[model samples]
Target: MLINCVAYQEGKKLADIPIEDISEYLSHPKCFVWVALRDASPEELATMKEEFGLHELAVEDALRGKQRPKIEEYGDSLFAVIQTVEPHGDELTVGEVAVFVGANYVLSVRRDAQQGLVGVRARAEREPHLLSIGSAFVLYALMDAIVDRYFPIVDALEAELEIIEEKMFASGAGAQRDNIERLYELKRKGLVLRHAVMPLLDAMGRLYGGRVPVLVENCQEYFRDVHDHLARILGRLDSVRDTIGTAIQVNLSMVAIDDSEVNKRLAAYAAIFAVFTAFAGVWGMNFEYMPELKWHYGYHMAICSMVIVCGYMYYKFRKSGWL
Candidate 1:
């Protein structure tokens, strides 16, 4: 669905134009048309292509969605794919935004992403000085908006790792188990956010230096700012991944330690039982040569001996911290 189609000239809004009137504004010097679409259909993309002279491959990629985060240059226009990250419950939901930017027009198509660029448009219009740079500034604005959204997710993942670390030391078996699962889940989300941000680092470099796109030549600093944000996000993602890996290993070690403690207790109990069994097995044997059985106090003496020996063993086990 088309969200908004507005035209701008001299860094100010002209009017909200219909889709059919996009070409007329495109022809005007110092004017650009901005169109926003949500889950755009192929027919809509085709019409956009016709209006903005968008590359066929770019339109195809936009219509299909699910493209890896990237920026590609086709002739005089640029196509960029950005992944949108949003928190859904305890999980992260990923979406895509495909932008087609030219000297005279900008088209943004969003898919599976709940958040839109309405704020970006408003901010751009409010800052006419930057918006006056033309379509490239719009591209930078959209990229900057998407990149900014990633900071909260990175912080959330970091917070989750800290929680899991605390649980690793303080929680019981069941809670620790849940923490391990939670850690893995957060790691997965971090990776998803990483994939979304990592590719843009290199792709965006082309916009700032060395044969830079004409529309972005004067806005190198803006593009560079976006790159720095992405780099920071990628760095934090790496840290989160390493921390999660360490947390998982620590959790496994805790499980092993618990198992070892259980084994020691079981072994201690078995040792105590073995002492009594040994005494009974010896006394249970029926033979003519059994001299202790001939005495009346022999039965009482044997019972006392068994009890004393077992008690001694129990005391030793307890003192050693095994029971």
Candidate 2:
């Protein structure tokens, strides 16, 4: 669906034009059109293609909506895909935004993403000087908006990792299992966020460095600033992944140590029971050859002896920290 189709001239709002009128405004040298769409259909994209002269391959990719984050140039226009990451419930939801930028127009198609570019539009309008730079500045505004959204998510993941780390050494069968599961979940979310940022970083580099696009050449510093933000986000993402890996390992180690301790206690108890069973087995032999059978106190004396032996063994085990 077409969300908005507005034209701008010299960084000022010219008029809200219909999709069919886009070409008329494009005829003006100083004017540029910005079109926003949400889950656009084939017919809508076809219309856009006719109006803006968008590349067919770029339109197809945009229509598909799951393209990896990237940027490509076809003749004078640039096609860029950016992944959108949003926290939904306890997990992250991944979406895509494909932008087609040319000298006179910018077409943004968003899929599976709830966040919109209304704020970006407002921001660009407020800075007419920057907006006067045309579609390139608008592209930067959109990229900056998407990259800024990532910070809160990164912070959330880091905070979750910290909580999981604290629970790493916690003692409980259920708690240990929960900690491991949480760590894995955190790692998964980190990868989702990382996937969104990494590709965009590479794409942004193209805007600022060698043979930059004509529309973006003058805005190298702005794109560079965005590249720096993505770099920081990527760095933090790496740290989160590493910390998650370490947490998983440490949790497994604690579980192993706990199991080993449990086994030692079981062994100590088994040894104590063996001492009593040895005497009992000897007495249970059905034979007149059993000498203790003749004495009335034999049963009592045997029981006392078994108790004393088991008690001594229990004390030794306790002292050794195995019971």
Best by lDDT: 2
Over 1-323, each residue of candidate 2 has an lDDT whose tens digit, in order, gives 99999999999999899987898999998999999999999999999999988999999999988888998999999999988899999989999889999999999999999988899999999999989999999988998899999999999999988878777778876788899998888888898998889888988878997888787888999989999999999999999998888888888888888899999999999999999999999999958977899888999999999999999999999999998
lDDT of 1 by residue, 82-171 (tens): 999999987789999999999989999999999878999999999998888899999999999999999998988898788778778764
Clashing pairs in 2: none
Please give the clash total of every predicted structure, in order.
0, 0
Residue pairs of candidate 1 with colliding backbone atoms: none
Q: TM-score each candidate.
A: 0.97, 0.97
Candidate 2 — what's its lDDT? 0.92
